[model samples]
Target chain A: MELFHLVLRNLLARPVRSFLTLLGVVIATTSMVLFLSFGEGLRRSLAQELSRVGPAIQIVPEGMEGLGFSGYPEITPEEYRRAVAAGKDLGVKRITPTLFLVRGGFDPQTSFFFQGLPEGVAPDLLYPGIKPQAGRLLPSEEGAIVGAKVAKRSQLALGNPLRLSPRVELRVEGILEESGGLADNLIFVPLKPLQEVLGTENYTALLVALNPGQKAEEVARALEARLPGLKAQTTGDVMRFAERALRISDLVRFGISLVALVVGGLLVANTVMMSVYERTREFGVMRALGAKRGFIFRLVVLEALLLASFGGLLGLALGSAVSQAINLYTLGQVGLALSAVTFRLSLFALLVALGLGLSAGLLPAYHASRIPVVEALGRV
Target chain B: MMGAVRAENLGKRYRQGEKEVVALEGFTFAFPQGSTAVVGPSGSGKTTLLNLLAGFDLPTEGGVYLGEVALHRLSEDERAEVRLRHMGFVFQQWNLIPTLTAWENVAFPLFLAGLPPRARKERALDLLEKVGVLERAHHLPSRLSGGEQQRVALARALALDPPILFADEPTGNLDAESREQVASLLFHAGQERILVLVTHDLELAARAERILYLKGGRLVRQEVPGPSR
Candidate 1:
């Protein structure tokens, strides 16, 4: 314990150098935690959003498996009718066609996804747990329902007119309660009116709800088999596709974390090496005062451990703050929740910092232990 | 009775590039309990002989004994153990650890010896009082003057109350007045222990019970200033 105090005092003796080294560790550890936790948050958000949409299969034009809600080859009216018929034959209870369009937001450059459902389909039947918070659901071809986030962002209220284009406008019939998923950010209108606005005669995809005790995969396979030009995919297949699309993001996160760790380790090594060099003579004096090599080794390594532990704590705080700021900034438009700083992640960060400290301290501590008493004493 | 230190034909050699430079060779001596000074000129291997006697260095071809323990035959750790248990040392430049306060520096050996914190603190303060630096106990070595630092070093060397003490030019860096005061304290402190002084100060050398003169790594003469202690 006394030796530990001595080591601490040694670090305090060179305040500037120690502070700079600590700052380096803080920067590296903060970046590591931020990148990894953001990636984890994004992954969890994706899974939650997918799970909330329920275990329904989707029928889209052929080769549109992973293109989620955007830029898909539209299904012709005849194709849509045949796909709905095939779904009914495969034990599907409900088949609703939806047209997806991207329209400019209140701001010209920014855009949001607009989903169009059939005028008679109940919103609760399509989006479970979602209900009208105000007014009513879309009641006519010229009416619209704004999601919670869209209403909050665009300040659209019930009975207000929303302009889809220069010549197309719809009155806001209802506002949705927060659903805690992608539906929160969407704008919903009747299918025929959205098709007219998009200048298309076909739907983007069909949402098929399976009958009781009928498996989604079995029904999807049957629908695809019967409708030769359409593709049917279960919820699990969609999730896998989403995960594959995120592989590049995973690689980028891994790369950032790796770089942060290496930089942190190297910074620790450089700091410890410089400290050892500066204290060569003092170490010799300890040797002459009867300190063994093991004693010297422990003293130096203890300094590094303290530095890493403190730096890691600072990094965790900084990283968590940065994550909260990101969450506030993105506001879920990117479908990312950046507030996933779990206890497990905090523990992992501490362990990594400790391991790096020990690894980086090894060479310098060994060199300090091996310093020759006479030669070191001779140094000025 | 066994002498405090015994050396049998102790020799030390160094390799300066390709040549083997002999620092000390064919040296033999037995030092009893009291103050003895080894006076020599530069390059006369005074520090080398002191290092060999204190178990800080191994003799190239011979051995030294601290009482019954053969110093040269032991491993480095064992030799350090011996130094910690039975010997104390003061160097030429008052080499106190710069990061430590005066009291903390004095307590270091006690810390290495695994003494409890309260006991280490008590002993260190007592030693500082003995050396007349108790008031400056909280000052770091950098804050203290050369003389004060040496006093702290002296107090630290005496912390364990070892049976043998070695001083290698302890007053070499002090002013004349401080040197007189330090030399007096050193001689008085040696009354109960085996204090060996390596120096070229004639006046300090004359105060010892015996003085050995050396040149070319050889002891040329031994003079008894007065009756042996």
Candidate 2:
């Protein structure tokens, strides 16, 4: 108890030095938390977006994978029928074929990737839980369903005519609620009207929903084997590709976080070492008062641990506030807000702070414990 | 029980670069209850003898005993325990921790001994009152004068009610009036404990029951104050 009192007094004795050290830890911890949280949020948002595309296998034209944004290459009607037949033979539950038509929006300079689905085949099966927020579902071939962002940006109201081109005019039947991803940015139209506008009798991709007990990968493989010119990709395979695309940014964020932690550890070590140097005579006095070497060691370590814990908590609040601000700023532009901080992530950050404190204090505490009593006394 | 310290054929050596320096050698003495003074010049190893007696340092060639226990033969932790239970020290610099208030400094030893907080505080206040510094108990060492700091240090040394006490130049940094008051307190405090003081002041040395003179790290003679001076 006396030792603890002395430790507190010592820390309070040099308030400026202690505060500076704490500030260093706070900055480093804040950076680490922010970068790591951003990385986690980005990864989770991508995963959620991929998952929302449904538990179906996307069968695209084989060479379309390398095409950047020219839109999915059209597969012939004959080939689409053959793929659907093969999927049905493999116990598929449903198959939704979608045509991609890239056309200018109301503003001729801005283009929208318009998707066309058959009138009876529900787009809800491809994007589950997506319902019209302001109007009924598509009721006619000329009717269109627009995503929330598209509607907001275009200011299109229900029953309003949206002209994609001179020959393709459709009435806005519904506006979707925010689906939290790219789905909130698309415009859906009836397949036959879009096909008529594009003068095509084919779709760009087929979404195959397998039976409950069927494996997606196995069905994908079977479709690829039976349909020679089509590429069948399970959702997991798509997610893996997305993850690979995100790897560089994740690695960079991780490296920055690692540097921040190292800097925090170094700051702790330097502060402790300086404190030990300043209190040599005081420690000797404690030694003469019958304090063991271990007592001195524990005192130093306890001081560092206290500083780290306080700094970590403050950093967490600061980092979370900054992340929330970023989330608010990006939600409107990107249609996906940053992920919220979890309790587990907070606990992990605190644990990292504690581990850094212990590691940084080890050498300083050992040095404090090893000071020769007589020599330390002679300092005064 | 009152404890006694005895040093037998004690010697201490220091290595300065390649040269070996013998600081103290061939010292032999036994101290029972009451006061004794060790007088020597700056390089005469007076502090070395005190350190060995207090078990703060081990002798290079001999051993010290506290009652029936061989102090030098024990490990560092055991020596620390002995110091806590049986010995108290006052150094030339009034080595109170600068961060602690005088009261906390006085209560340090009791805290080390695992005494309850109420008991430690009461005992510390009592000792501070005895040393005439109870009113300064809340002041830090920096706030206290040199004499008051030394008095608080004295109270701290006696905190655990140790059987033996050692003071090294306790009045070296004080004015004449503070010195006289501190010296009076020291002599009165030594009435029931074995007190060994290391100092260069002959007048202070003469007040002790026995005075040992050292030269060239060796004890030259022992004397008792007398009219013959």
Candidate 3:
């Protein structure tokens, strides 16, 4: 018989203990995979959305310069004018002044991300490839174009009136075709109505698109130098900042997952140690029958590795299944696939499991190999 | 030095709470190449002598030699290697690995000796057949009767054709009829090899060409049992 078969038979001799140990590893791996997948998913989604944005640079209030800037618009009309005038001298495209407002609750029906641009600015000029799925873009200041996800969630169609306040209401002129990007969750309207609603004379940011042959980096540098109080951020700058933030969060997530890995490792150690202790007498018999100490050590350690391997594979399968289910739910809720199980993560989980097996097995295997033959044989 | 087994001033001591107990002391013997039985009552160092001579335990003050290699001076790992290459053992408890089938138990020594699977199986089957347990080769140790397990163990000890064999109360767990059957096979396996038996049965000891009586951790007498088989 092969040595592998011998180790297998030993583990199979008592099925309950092995299964319980396996279950502990599975739970640990599942939780780890599930938690880390969020970081992977957020990175992927942000990259996709960042690539789709039309503007090359955004000049905003200094602190509010990255993706998903949601604070009240603090940049005044004067600051926006200064940024636009400075960009006009450069090889720049049209500078669009936009205001952003968030009015909502946790419920999808009540939640709204409102982007207010100047009257008659074509939606495609600001968000490329945007077109009406149900109706046309805003034809007048009295009308609005709702994004695909928002429209579907609110069950709105063309000509349905959306209320921003008790006094400000506009007819839904169109519903945008789904692009599965950030714009899919916004409601686009004319700037005048939203400013009147906010009761403030301020602009959120000045969106700067560059003409052909103008590098955004140089233009953004010029814009920042021209306007000292305000900050000009390029798309690449925003993406890098977001990625850094995600990386820090990733570290925190992995630190939490490590807790589970440690517990799983302890379970493996306990199970293998008990097996070594209970089977010492058999080990002595084996030694008497001419089996070497190295062979006995390998037997015990191999058992641990087998258990860990099975647990890691099963955990990966289950974690992937769960991530797919989560993506399905998040896709329906926000038009975003928010959980990912990348190939690298699967490899990492398996390596961690094998590492756990080796570390857990060493002490027990040593004890088993060191046991005196006489004392072991002396046991009944 | 070759083919000769000898002990020189062999002694062993154990610590029990603040006192020392002598398990075996001042043992000297040149075991012949055939069969020899060491017999004594309980707590008379029968098993202790077997342990020292088999190199399973170290003697405190003396040494044992298999040819030129000193068993007592060798490290535990080295002693284990020697046992694997040259010594075969049968314990009183019929210590067949409970997880292995009858044939697998018999094949274990061959497997340890690095024999290929087919060759190990062939030799193990031949030995099992010789011991009259061939039909039960696939049954696990727990599923077999006590007599059958001991027979498989005997088959295992002879698997590698070792030059030295140690049987520690091999028939201690068997009934009278099964004892006779195991004793017959064991003696047949002893021919031309150094076979050492530690037993309490004088009847079984009579089958050996020589017997040494042990008492109070010392060898008291040696006699020629006169071939009664």
Strongest candidate by DockQ? 3
Q: Identify the superior model by DockQ, candidate 1 or candidate 3.
A: 3
Total residue pair clashes for candidate 2: 0
iRMSD, model 1, in Å:
2.4
TM-score of model number 2: 0.88
Ranking by lDDT: 3, 1, 2
State residue B202's C-alpha deviation in candidate 3, in Å: 1.0
Query: DockQ of each candidate's interface versus the true one?
Result: 0.48, 0.55, 0.67
Give the per-residue lDDT digits (tens) of candidate 2, residues A183-218: 687788888877787678878788788888899898
- Tell me how far candidate 2 lies from the true structure as C-alpha RMSD in angstroms: 3.8
- Relative to the unseen true structure, what is the C-alpha lDDT of residue A120 in candidate 2, on a scale of 0 to 100? 71
| lDDT of every model, 2 decimals | 0.83, 0.82, 0.87
lDDT tens per residue, model 2, B76-157: 7778888888888887799988888898888889988999999989999999999999999988899999999999989999
> Which candidate number would show the highest TM-score if scored against the true structure?
3
